[model samples]
Target: MSRQIQSRSYLIPIHLDENHWSLLVFNINSKQIINFDSLYNIDKNIAIISNLISILSKYVTVLKGAQNWNFFQNYSAPRQSGDIDCGVFVCQYANEVHSILNMKQFDIICFCETKIEDSYPNSFYKNDYYYKIRLDRSRHGGGLIIFIKNSFVLTKSVHPENTELIYLQFRKSGQLNNFIYTFRAPNLKEQLFLEKLEDFIHSINLNEPLFIVGNLNMDFSDKIKSNISKFADHNDLINFVKTPTSI
Candidate 1:
C-alpha cells in the first residue's frame, strides 16, 4: 500500500461507526497525521483519530522503516451547519488544500473583481507562503488582490487616488522584472477611466519592464476600434488575451 502512494501528502477518509465521516491528512513531509473534522468535536473525535493513526503507523513503520508520527487534531477547518453536510465539507477541504498546494508553482497571483470591502483585515487572507496585498473596491463593484511569494524583496508604489489600480515595484529580485500594475476599469465613466489609465501609463518608465494585467472591459475587435486598443498601441503594449471574452 505504501508503494502505491506517489504523493508526499495523502488524505484518508475515516468512517466512524458507519454513521459519521472525518478526514486524516498524512503529511510525510511534516511527519504528522493532521485530522480535520467538520464537527469540531475534540473530545469525541480525537481518540478515534488517534487510534486509527496508531494502527496505520504500524504498517507505515514496517513498510517505510521505523518513524515517529505526530498526531494533530482540532485543525481550524470549516464546520458544517447541519449533520448531513460532513461529506460535502470534507470534499471542500480536500479541494482547498489541493489548490493551495498547486499555487506553489507561481511566484505571483492576481485576483480581480474580488468584491472584498476595505473593512477586512490583511490577516483575513494571510498565508504562510505568500505576502498578500489587497486593494479595496472604490465603488460597490470590484476589488483587487495580489499575492507575491515571500522569497522576493519588493516594494509597492503609490497609485492614483480613488481608482482601481495596484502598482508593485520589485527591487534586486533576479529574473523578475521591474513593476506589476493590476487594475479593474469601471463599467461607468468610460472617458474618465480612460483618461486616468492613459495618464498612468504615460507616467511609467519606458526602460523598465512593466506588466499590466486585469479587466479592461473593452472589445478588441478590429471593427470596433476601441480607444483602449489605441491606448495600448500608442504605448506599444500587446494584448495577450486573444480569444473574445463574450459573443
Candidate 2:
C-alpha cells in the first residue's frame, strides 16, 4: 500500500514475484505511474494497474479523489533479453529515467549568457593565449573596441583614414600572412567604408587566407556587392556563409 509521499519525489519500486522482477515509477507531484516489464497483455495489464491503484488508495487519499489515477493504457516498455536479465533491465530503466529527470532540472537553472564588467586581468586572461584589446575612445556617441587573442604575434593593421573597419594581422616567426577583419557598417558612411576597404584589400598580399566576419548592414547593391564579389573571386577567397544571420 502507498502512503503520502514527499512533494516532487519520485518513487521507483521493484516488484518481485517468486522468480520474476518488474519496475514501476511513481511521481508524487504529477501522480504519474510508469510500469515496465518484459511481457504484457492488454487485459492482464489493465487488471494489474487497477489492482495497484486500489492498493495505493487503501493507505491514502488524494485531494482530487481516487478516480484520477492514470492507468496509461496501451503501455510499452523495454523488454528483457532472458529470464535472469529482468532485474538488470529494470535497474537500467530506472537509471535512464533519473538521468532524464536530472537533465530537465538542470535545464531550468543553467545560464545562457554572462556579462563581464571588469576591465582586464580576469581569471580567463591567463589561459592558452595572450590578449590585446583596443577600447572605444569616443566621448559619447560611437564607441567600439577590438580583441585579439592567439598564440601568434599580432599587430594593429594599417587602414585608410576615417574608416570604420578594424583589421588585425597574425604573425609568427617574423612573418605576417594571416589576417582578420571586422566592421560595423553605418548607412551614412557606406560609400567611404567601401572605398577604404578596396584600398586596404589592394594594399595586402592576397596569397594567404583571410577571415572577415561582421554585420555589414548593406543589402544587394551593384556598387558594394559587385565590388565585394569581384574582390573575393579575384583573391580566391570563399564566402562559406550564405544564410541571413539576423531577422
Counting clashing residue pairs in each candidate, in order, gives 0, 0
lDDT tens string, model 2, 17-80?
Answer: 4334455555566676666666543355556555655555553444233336564431467775
For each of the candidates, the C-alpha root-mean-square deviation to the true structure, in angstroms, is 13.8, 23.6
Q: Report how far residue 65 has shifted in candidate 1, in Å.
A: 44
Report every candidate's CA lDDT.
0.65, 0.47
Clashing pairs in 1: none
Question: What TM-score fits each model?
Answer: 0.55, 0.39
Best by the lDDT measure: 1
Model 2 clash pairs?
A: none
lDDT score at residue 98, model 1, on the 0-100 scale? 35
Task: Please report the candidate that would top TM-score against the real structure.
Answer: 1
Model 2 Cα shift for residue 172 (angstroms): 6.0
